[model samples]
Target: MSELLAPALSGAAAGLGVAMPMGAMSVLLLQEAVRERRPAVAAAAGIAAVDLGYAALATALGPWVAAHVTPAEAWIRLAASAILLTIATRGLLPTRPAPPPTNASPGAGASAGPATELGTEPGPSAGAGPGPGPGSGANAGPSAGPSAGAGAGAGRTFARYVGLTAVNPTTALYFAALTTAQGAALRAGAAGAAFVTGVALASLLWQQALVALGALAGSRISPAARTWTFRLGYGLVAAYAVKIAFPLP
Candidate 1:
C-alpha cells in the first residue's frame, strides 16, 4: 500500500511538473478555450492522453528511448518548431472576410466573420443569448450547421491536441529521465499502475483548469477582445517556435 502510494504521489508530481510549464502547447490550449469554438474538454483529454502515452513508453523503454531519442533531439525540435510556426501563421491570417457594418442596407448580404482566425467553429455574437436568430452568431449560418458541428467534434479536437503535444521532444525526454531514475519503484506490480494513473489524473486536472480559465475569460470579453486575445496567443506561439528553432545559450 505504502509502496503504491509513494510511487503514485511521485508520478503525480512529475506529471504536474511537465504539464504546468507554459509553452507553445499551453498557449494554443488557452486560445482554444478562449475561442470556445472547439470543445476544450476534448482538448484537455487529448493532452493528458498524449502525456499518458509518453509516460508509459518512457517507463517501459527508458533505456532504449534515452539512447535513440537523444540522438534525434535536434531533428525533433526542428520539426516541432516548424509545425508550431505553421499553426501560428494560419491563426494570424483571417479565415474569412469580415461582415458588413451593422448599418448596411437590407439587401446587403452579411458575411459572417470567423469567430477567431483559428479555423474552427464560428462564435456567438457579442452578448448574444443561446438560440438561433440574427444575434445567434454561430447558429446563424449554414456554415455552423450539422456538417460544421460534426467537423468540430471532440474526436477532431482530441486528435489535434494529441498531435500537437506529441511532437514535443521534451515531453518524451522528461518522462524518460524520470523513469530511469525511479524505474524500480515505478515497475513494482500495482505500484506501476498507480503511478501511471496518478500521472494521467494530474495532467488531466491541470489541463481542465486551463480550459475553465479560458472559458471564463471568453464569457467576459467582447468579441473584439477575443480576437485580440487570439492574436496575442498565436504571437506567443510563434515566439516559442522561434525559440525552439534556435535556443539561446
Candidate 2:
C-alpha cells in the first residue's frame, strides 16, 4: 500500500509535469484571457476538461490505442495546425465594426455632434443630437463591443480547445507514456482514481490561476496598452501556428 501510494502521487505529479509547460494552448489561453477575460476562462476550462478525458483514456487503454492508431499522430498535428492558423488569422484581422448605436429617444439626452466636432469644444446645444448621448459615438467604438465578440469567441475557443486536444497526437502519446509508467502503482483501482483526480484538480487550479493573473494585468493596463498587448499576443499566436505548420528540422 505504501508503494502504491508513492507511485500514485508520482503519477499525479507526472501528469502535472506534462501539463504545466507553456505550450501553444497555454499561450492562446493567456492571450485570450487578457483580451477577453471570461471567454478565456471558459476556453481554459474546456481544455482542462478535454485533457481529463484524454488522460483517462490513455490510462485505461494505452496499449490498444498504441497498437491501432498508427496514423493518428499525423492527423492530430494537421488538425492542430489548421486550428491554430485559423485562430491566428482571426486575431490578425481587424475587429468587426461596432454595432450601430441604439437610436436615441426623441427626448433622451443621447446625441453626438458630427465626427469633426468630436475633439472640439462642445457647443451649448451639443446635447440636442440625434442619438442617445453626446459622447455616445466616442464611447461606442470597437473597444466597447467586446461583449459582442465575447460570446462567439468563447464558444469558438471552447470548440477549438476540444479539437486541439483530440487531435494532438503528441498529447495522446504523452499520456500513454505517463499512464504506462505509473500503471503498476495505479493497478490498485482506488489509488489510480485518486491520482487521476489529483491531476485534473491541479490542471484546473493552475489554469484558473492563469486566468486570474491575466485579468489582473488587463485591469491594471491603460486601454491603449491593452489594445497593443492584445495585438502583440495575437501576433505571437500567429507565429506559433506558422511554426507548428512548418516545423524546423
Candidate 3:
C-alpha cells in the first residue's frame, strides 16, 4: 500500500504539472463552463481521460515516441494553432437572431370559420410556459440556446475536448520524458496503476474547479457581460494560436 501510495502521489504531481498551466484548452473550458455547466463537466472529463491516455501511451512507448515525434513537433503545433484559430473565429462571430413568424392573412382563416361561428374560443398556446429568467436554466429553450445544444450533445462535447487535448502530442512527450526521468518507478505494474489513477484524479479535479469557477462568474454577470467575456476569451485564444504557430527561439 505504501509503495502504491508513493507512485500515486508522484503521478498526481505530474498530472498537476501538465494540467495547471493556462493554455488554449483551459480558456475554452472556462468559456464553455460559463455558457453551460453540464457540457463543461463533460468537457472536463474528456480532458482528464486524454491526459491519462497519453500518460499510458508514454509509459508503453515512451522512448520511441520521444525520438521519432520530436522532428514533427512544429507541424503538430501548427495544426493545433489552426484548430484554435478556427474556434476563436467562430466564437467571435455574432449570433444571428431567429426570424419572426409571419402573420396569417385575413382570408386565410375563412376556411376554418370564425371562432364565434364554431361556438368555441381558441385555447392557450400549446406548450406555453414562462420564459427563462436570467442566471437560470429556464432560458435554455428546447431547440436553441447554449444549454439546449450543449446539454443535449454532452457526448459530442466530451469528444471535442478529447480532440482538443489530443491535438498536442507534446503532452505525450511530457509524460515520456517523465518516464525516462523516473526510471523503474513507472515500470512496476501496481505502481503504474496507482500513477495512472492519480493522474486522472488530479487533472479532473483542477478542470472541474475551473468549471465551477466559470459557472459562478457567469451567474454573477449579465448576459451582455457574458457575451463580451466570451469574445474576450476567444480573442485570447486567437493570440495563443499565433504564439503556437510561431514559437520563439
Candidate topping TM-score = 1
Tens digit of per-residue lDDT, candidate 3, span 27-123: 8888877766777899999999999998887776678879977888888889999998988887676422324325756566555466424433221
In candidate 2 the C-alpha lDDT for residue 61 amounts to: 79
Instruction: Assess every candidate by TM-score.
Output: 0.81, 0.70, 0.78
lDDT of 2 by residue, 181-236 (tens): 76565656776666667667767777777778877886677544654565676677
Clashing pairs in 1: none
Query: Distance (Å) between predicted and true CA of 178, model 3?
Result: 0.7
For residue 82, give model 2's deviation from the true position in Å.
1.4
lDDT of 1 by residue, 47-135 (tens): 99998998888878887888888888888899999999988887777523444456655454334334333333344544232211122
Quick one: how many clashes does candidate 2 have? 6
RMSD of each: 6.2, 8.7, 9.0
Q: Identify the runs in model 1 with alpha carbons over 4 angstroms from their true place.
A: 95-106, 109-152, 247-249
Candidate 2 Cα errors over 4 Å, as ranges: 1-8, 95-160, 246-249
lDDT of each: 0.76, 0.61, 0.76
Q: List the residue pairs that clash in candidate 3.
A: none
